[model samples]
Target: MSILIDGLLAILAIYLALQSLLAPRLSQSVFLFFAFGLALALAWVRLGAVDVAITEAAIAAGFLGVLFLDALRDFSSTISEKHNNTEAIQSSASRKKIKTFLLPRLAFGVGLGLFLLISLEAIWQIPQGGGLTAAAESMLPESGVEHPVTAVLLNFRAYDTWLEIGVILLGLLAIFVTGGIKIYTKPDVVAKDPLLRQVILFFTPVLFLFGAFLLYIGKSGPGGAFQAAVLWGAIGILLHLGGKPVFAMIPRWVGQLVLIMGLGFFLLMGFVFMSGGATLFEYPKAYAGTLILIVETLAAISIAAALTAIYANLNQMKEEPKENESAN
Candidate 1:
């Protein structure tokens, strides 16, 4: 059974890779890749790797799937191209001229060959020296978290996580900045969908609250920064799709300051620790939960705004005075 399951998963992964490479429409590819992620999570769980499975399911299956779909939506053609689910041709007579594509093919082949050669050596031999499980076992008691990976994420490799948060913030800033120049349009109106609209309106707030709850619970459980951020972002997306007000065109200073507040405050906290003769970001256990909760909440708010702004790129809008001043 185990062998069969693994083989099926391998086949699914191969199929997903091909679908992504060959799908004429990008949307199909993204959703198929998401299915691939689900398969990967299953495989991880079978291997007794819960952390990797959670990451695969939550980070890749959920958040990455949404992110890719969002990107596909953004790249939507001027006219919606409707595609039929027709059987794909297995062999192509020819595709775009080879001279233009040959170089990329050659480069990809070389890269894949080298990667395989390097990877095989590592996979075939068992490491005789330090192993991750041993290191994690040694560090768990000192980490103050039951889950080893969480301990590593928050404590052992905190600086790495902090920098990653910075990268996320930068990516959000770039999206918002570039999105400002984008033409914003209201989503297509659905006719006589009062029942569905009412249903959505009724439960949307509840969902938002649930997402917040997940984020808060993350401190003690399998959830955390990424999961919470995605949930919060999902609420904003739902609000936007439901045609609710989903933007805040604040002053540039306000936006910039809000964007940096999490990192700024984190750095200040680190400075305080360092001033007390502790190393950089060597957060005292005393302030751990409080500091983490604060950072998480701020991050959630900033992330929500950035995600909403991706859809609603309202540039700086001048307030319109009452009625006929311009006409006069």
Candidate 2:
């Protein structure tokens, strides 16, 4: 039964992934990608990595799905505004020509086949039952957290985790550079439905409570900072959709501070530990668990803020004026 279930999940994941890439319409591809993400999450669960499954579902299916839909909307509007029917038809014909080109398709198929064979060979070469499992298990007692995943992430390899948080901030910075630091001065044009408002009211507190619960439970289970961050970020998105932009209501400096709080605190703690003759991010055994909890808490908050800011910026992005409009 387990084997059959795993086989079905594997097939579904592969099918969705291929379809997402090859779909005829952009909207179709985006929706297919969401399905692929969900399928992948199920595969992860079957592999007993519940934490990874949760992160994959939340970030890939939830956050990225929204981002892709927003991009699609902008892309479609721009295409409609900039190109007439004749140009659109010509472009479509050119794409069809490229798609039907025999030589290019043949070469791509050959290359992909070779790549798949190489990947299979590499996977087969990997020695089974030969990883750091034993070592990690032995060191788990001293790593400060009951959950091995949490221990490895927040204690055994904390520097890597710290860098991961920094990377998220850097991504946000890159988005800001591209979009020129858009601060939302007003709420987005959301639907003025009473049910939408009611939904937001109902989920706001629930999401907060759930996010905090996940953060606290990470010490012993398959919940952690990243998972909690996604939930908290969802709250910001909900508020934005409900015509109450949280970041817009707050001071710019305050928003910036929140964005940097996680990475800054992480580095400060690392340096403080280094000053006491310990290696950077190497917490003393006596205070390791407490310190990890504090770091995770701050990292969650910072990550949530960064994600919300990203969504807000992307949502508020205006299409550039066309040449005729600009001339006028």
Top lDDT: which candidate number?
Answer: 2
Off by over 4 Å in 1: 49-52, 59-63, 70-118, 126-128, 177-192, 249-258, 311-328
Worst 10 residues of 2 by lDDT: 77-86
- Give the alpha-carbon lDDT of every model: 0.64, 0.86
Q: Candidate 1's residue-wise lDDT over 104-172, tens digit each?
A: 779999999999988988888857876688888886666555556666776677787678668877776
Q: TM per model?
A: 0.72, 0.90
Global lDDT for candidate 2?
0.86
C-alpha RMSD for every candidate = 6.9, 3.9
Best by TM-score: 2
lDDT of 2 by residue, 269-289 (tens): 999999999998899999989
